[model samples]
Target: MSDYICNWDHCKFEGTKNLAIRHVIITHAPPEKVPYFCTLCSFRATNLKAFERHLTTFRQHILLEKENSQTKEYLQISTESYNVTWGNRNCDLTLKNEKYLYPEPNIVPVLLEINEDYTVYNETIIESTASQTEENNENIEKLKTKHKREMNNLAEYIIRLEKKLSARDQEIFELKRELRCNEPFIQGFNEMWEDQVRDKKEQRDRKREDWRRGKVAKENMEPLGETFSSPPSKKMKSLVKKLF
Candidate 1:
């Protein structure tokens, strides 16, 4: 068998020349000066390959809490615009609340106001003169009664439409309330998985250290027969003489 001996000074390591060189290098190095530093933990590695292995097994996550402080800014409608749009519109609705008109009472029919939203509020007035007091007066009275009934029907139809719109706006408001929130969900972390990985790595490192120590001890101590070996005694000489 061929023997490969290490040529390093005072190094009796006989198998791998590189292992002896590494041992000598580590022995002279400062105890506190380890090669790889883990930014997440206190663990340090001896070599680049070990450092990379350590990183893969001992990786950790950093927790960061972000503040959810942003809020939506909505335009506030001016009072004047509100009055012209909704309030003033209601003023005309109030006038239409009492649509009946009488010539003797000087109650003029409501004048129609056409709004930007295409809604029209109407007013109509009629007058009877003393000179036109003829037989057609009764027919005119019938016409007035018919017009009044038609106006009442139109008013009720508009009111029902407005009520439906109000109900739709209420539904929209409820949906918006349900969707609004002050806090938002963030990314999750798994503590149990990280802990398991850490424990497994620790077990592997401990076993490796124990195996290395045993190998070094075996190399340094000689075998039992080799340690006690000597020249043959008188009994060994007689046995050899008789055999001859």
Candidate 2:
């Protein structure tokens, strides 16, 4: 057998060329026919955005290079290109990358406290404080809304199914009713057919009996003119001789 090898790193699948091609086509390529190959890993996506997400969010290659957290060091903050970190380690930023105009860390507050009709901001912590409480509430509300919507949709679907089932059942009932109504007519037809067969049999038997009786009578009958006692003549003698 010819060797068909998958060149993707960490992949152990080896087969014939056709099998390897089939496996790649089925596993890596999407049905939409777009090719999105991952630069770092064996993962393939259907579109560029999906490939980018796979590169940043699901960084299988980046995580492979990540050392154990026992070693601690200050990592620089990159501003030129946005990148998601690999592990659960924090990086102390001394200077931002050249992408951002501001030297200080870009701060965007997620949640604002309304104090006497004025929005208050906490300057110390950059990013959203909403991650502490509001995020969970929002998630819970979204889940509830989604669940309710799904339930309503399911209920509507069930109602449609029930309606169809009811209509089908009604149609079946009507067919059964029609069959029941025709039962008497079917029975009458069967009885008429049986009666006709019986009558024909009786007529055939009567004919056979009549024929047998006529044959017996004919066999028992005397010769022609035997019952008439006439004078002994040459003509009668000749007729008797001929009949005998």
- Name the candidate that leads on lDDT: 2
> In model 2, which regions exceed 4 Å deviation?
1-172, 225-244
lDDT of 2: 0.46
TM-score of 1: 0.20
User: Residue 21 of candidate 2: its Cα lDDT?
Assistant: 42
**Tens digits of lDDT, candidate 2, 1-244:** 5344443334444455444443333253332221333322334332334434433443233342355311212211112211211111131111122111212224321222111211111112223533533465567779989999999999999999999999999999999999999999999999999999999999999999999999999999987787575568899789999999
Q: Which candidate comes out best when scored by TM-score?
A: 2
TM-score of each: 0.20, 0.27
Cα deviation of 131, candidate 2, in Å: 40
Q: Candidate 1 at residue 136, lDDT? A: 53
Writing each residue's lDDT as its tens digit, candidate 1 over 1-244 gives 2123323234333323233223322332222332333333333333444434433432121111122111111111111111111112222111222222211212222322222221111111112322233335556667879999999999999999999999999999987776564213211235666788999999999999999999999999878896568677899899999999
Error of 2 at 191 (Å): 2.5
